[model samples]
Target: MRISACCFKFLAIIFWICPTAIAVAQSNDAQRHVIVISIDGFASYLVDDPKVPLPTIRRLAREGCVVEGGMTVSDPSVTWPNHTTLVTGMKPGRHGVLANGVLVRGGIGVPVKIDSHRDHSDLVRVPTVADVAHAAGLRTAEVNWPCTRNSKSFDDQFPDVPNALDYTTPRLRQELVKKKLLRDETHASFRNSSIVGLDYVWTEAACHLIRERKPHLMLIHLLNNDATHHKRGAQSQAGYTANAYADMCVSRIIDAIDDAGIREHSTIILVADHGFTVTPKAIRPNVLLREAGLLTVENGQLTQAQVHVVPEGGIGLVYCTNPLKASEQAAEFKKLLTGQEGVADVLLPDRFDEVGFPHPRDYRQVPDAVLVAKDGYAVSGTVTGETLVTTFEEARTSYGSHGFLAKLPKMKAMCILSGAGIRPGTQLQDVHNTAIAPTIATLLGLKYPDADGKPLLNALRTSADAE
Candidate 1:
């Protein structure tokens, strides 16, 4: 009974291989670890923002490949859809998460902002890279990544694991508590606490996992930067602080890998969900509808509404009462929105497919028409008598916002990759969001058979070798 050479070598690191042909292949490959860090609201332009010294981010750029043109976020350019797209290699249209929330049957639904603890895995129609990696015998971990609640793709999960926002693993919590990094009041009230405090707790938890569990594939989403930028403009003092804080968080995770003796064996990928733009003007198209008696607000309830403007920052979806008469309503909507101030482009149903939007026939919440705000203008969710156009200083304004058309240069997301088997100091252009999952999956020697993205080969060691 002679055992094969490959089988003997696999037995040496038996823990890494779960079992299967692909797992065997991955175990044979040099790639071992992947730690994906998603910094929400990070724009490609920030890679050179001279305002502050983003030491960690700059280090990554200096040492690894930077996707120069930027990673194009999914349409609507919101959080959850793009995050899901990052892992699944599918657009929001293909992945069934067309937006943060779906507008259903002429009624708007709450966004799936935070993943529910229930088995909502079916919400995503496609399999994530984690699922593929897990199937290939790799342990996966997710910390506060959207659409990952109760997901079977991961073996070790925090935040999503216990239906809690903080990584409340009993031991992990206690360790931070003893270290004076966490207190009961702070941990218990994290949901209502400052963005910095919540992120501090989460970052420590990620470090704990990396130092202890050492998952083969780990994804960490930091929300402080997004929250801060939304409150203060992207170039504001607070925005700089939030981004610097995110950089530090990444540094800690990298340190954890080094402390765990897996630095050389691990691969680190940095990406942002979407970019940011300072929205100086607010447009409330619904205000006009209310004035025209097309919509009614009785005690703040939408009672009689013919059109509902579902505001998504720089973009708005005008939903008609009759999806059956969408064609007719679209024509009216185009004229109605075109006459309104701060409206950049009124995209009708015919342009949905052109802009990579989910066709009306494919989505449950596809709107009659899309309204794009002009540069320096953003849409608001106000359906009442708010002004049609008002300065951000005068209105209840966001210092910054996203969810704009991806064609806008300022809306482009960022991607920085540096790790083992990657071409250091490489700069790739025209990188899209769909290409990410496939590259990560392929690096681990796993097959991303369903991926729509092409593997970014120019940044890889193989590509460098060919060169």
Candidate 2:
């Protein structure tokens, strides 16, 4: 039977549009975007704490999966290393970022320092989730994300470093300057800006990227809360204010996604590098080292040293510059470090692997031993000071600090995954920050087989079905 003219025309139109519509739908599905917001010192406990006014974070937690106990950060719970773990799904040992900065070995007679002015390639040994996604033709952005300086993987990069303005992607920096989101383009202006002001600037940068580019994978980091906590201690009134501001920043990001018309298609993961611990005492292990003749200081300068302890918040990395001497006086060093005030225990190099750190024998950045600070104590790098231990009041004032053993409950980081393919109100017992990257990789329809973490299958729609 011959079709009527009107029906024929209608059928023709349907046939012609069908393929294009199908392709559009497929493209939309493939265009899933992920926004990861890291509140630097957001403790898991604070998510439920009635005192910390984080309505936005709490709402997200209510809508998404919340790690019950808390997410365990990498060993020596610190910012850069844990942030790297969140994106790489690997610990410090594998990722090759042992500290907040690159740990430089100063050899036998020199003191070591963590050089923060380093490039991404100079620190990270493994590919991040952003790198993997970008390699697979997905657009990526990073705003104030650590260890991402000069990362070619990101389509837009605004790094978190001393001279952050100098390293930002040229186009993005110009755009930001033109918009006055960044008032001045100079690194000095950025450095002089207050922590709270910089936090707002960083959030504005992230919001701009979301509205303008809608990157497939975007990582945003806000730092005011961490700085505030470091100054006034966690749960302090000042910390509450900073945290509230960070929550507002998160709200702004969500708004930007909605404005970009990709709210429904986007996934937001709220995380933290590590939790904070209020320390009243500061332990100066270097003083003990000097007294023990393991270290030497002259003319108020550390001109020479056998073993130098670099304090990293609640933990101290004891570097034995002379490996042979370290072996010879291992027992003596242990005796001196062990049972000291504010000293919890000394972790020898042999146990480094057990705690997800590279052994000193293999990695020069690895310390000969790790001095674990006890609760209410923080390690300090004061060799010239007469006292081996002192109260926080004497130094400045009692403040909050992190970089403790990952096993400590106080060192647990925060984790909240929401939107897109996530199951609302889902909860996991205790998660590791390492698992975050693989989960993000799965959400982006990519495989990160080499990652040490497994995706949170129970919290994801497609993966949960597979389970």
Candidate 3:
């Protein structure tokens, strides 16, 4: 009787452990893994350069689909709007991000903080890819992704925000505490002075989250390169170093995923918000238009002009009140701007709109005239010596700027897709920014509503088989 009882107990233990192990293995296989990595300020040149030691990225390109020239919609090409477009798959106008800084009503003295959170509701009109993924029963996570703060999209998010001004002063910790923005216990963990390029820290936090709570879909945005370009310019050694550092961070995350034993089952997509350019001279087209009587100022505010130019610092957008007047203004602005110390080319709004950007509903909000500067020329709003000198000259130390027309050779972003369900060694050209979300949805078998981006069927094995 005793021997029979022991035998029964042994059998029951085996029954319990065996099913648990098998269930875990099955769960790993049944679920799909997706990781979207945004390397801020990444231009196509990095991957194209053999000398750059981006081994993981190189492997992805060689093994996965590579969109050699991923195009951006339009300019200021600044971070917030560009990043918003990537996940939302909508143009700036549709999504309403508009610029890094939106003009406040009542001319509020300070610029509204435009970090990954929509402090004002209903600003972001569309659903993010993560939103679609979650609705389909997939888990989601984001790290340092812009405009993610207080976002309703992600299941788990570590939104990026500008380091508070007090962060630089002695009262940093106290201010963070008083505002209830961070806990005192977190002070030691987040005590870095230069928060801009803290890719390693961001990745560390992400890795911990991945291990502690395995998310099916994850989005990570690394900004070392962007910061380096903003401070050192795009072509400088600092920018190169920043790129290499970002690549290293990417490698680390890949290793983390591998260690978690999800390498083969996971798909990794690497992309950039926009490319960068270096500007040497700063041009203020509004001042010139003001002088030309094409623009007028009343009560310290700018009013209607035949051609209105808004300085994005590096590139200027021109809005024409009269479409007929555009040609005339273009001719005159061309004569007035070209080769005049800092000017590059004057682009008409009609030609500018051809990049597939819809016209702004509020014409008063967009520039009637647009200006492209030479590699070193930047635009400004300050007046000095007849020419409006926004900053005497564009900052020389920074190596990066973007927001020029996508047609420019230097303005192309990069895209790499690799993983279990993806077709290997596929090279796609002419992929638009809008197609990213749909592609992600197709991979996970999720329903993405109102997505502007179409899935490239050729890039996915499952998609091809389904077709």
Per lDDT, the best of the predicted structures is 2
Candidate 1: where are CA atoms >4 Å away?
A: 1-31, 106-119, 159-163, 166-188, 393-397, 463-467
Expressed as tens digits, the lDDT of each residue in 1-467 for candidate 2 is 32232453354345333433211222444679999999998988888888888888889989988998789999879899999999989888777788889888877777788999999978887667777777666889999999999987899999988799899999998998998977778888777879888988899999999999999899999999899999898788998888889899999999999999998889999999999999988988888888878778888667788887888888888887877787556556778878878889888866776677755666678788888989889888877777778987664434799988888898888899999989988999768888999999888877776678899988888754537
- Native RMSD of candidate 2 (Å): 11.9
What is the TM-score of candidate 3? 0.74
| Candidates 1 and 3, the one with greater TM-score | 1
lDDT of predicted model 1 = 0.75
* lDDT string, candidate 1, 48-118, tens digits: 88996689988988898999878888787888788888987877766666565444563432221222343
TM-score for candidate 2, please give it: 0.92
| lDDT tens per residue, model 3, 1-467 | 11232343354345333433212222334568888898988887677765566777888888889986565444556676677777767666555565564532212121112233243123444556665666555677887776655555466666655432222223433443464444452534464536443576667656655665567888888888877887677667777777778788888888888877778778898888778777644666667767877666776456445655545545666555565455576667877777766676666555545543344333223344567766655666432235644343432223346766566667778888998788888999888776777777677766555556677677888644547
Model 2, residue 363: C-alpha shift (Å): 0.9
What is the TM-score of each predicted model, taking all chains together?
0.87, 0.92, 0.74
Q: Comparing 2 and 3 by lDDT, which wins?
A: 2
Measured by TM-score, the strongest candidate is 2
- TM-score ranking of the models: 2, 1, 3
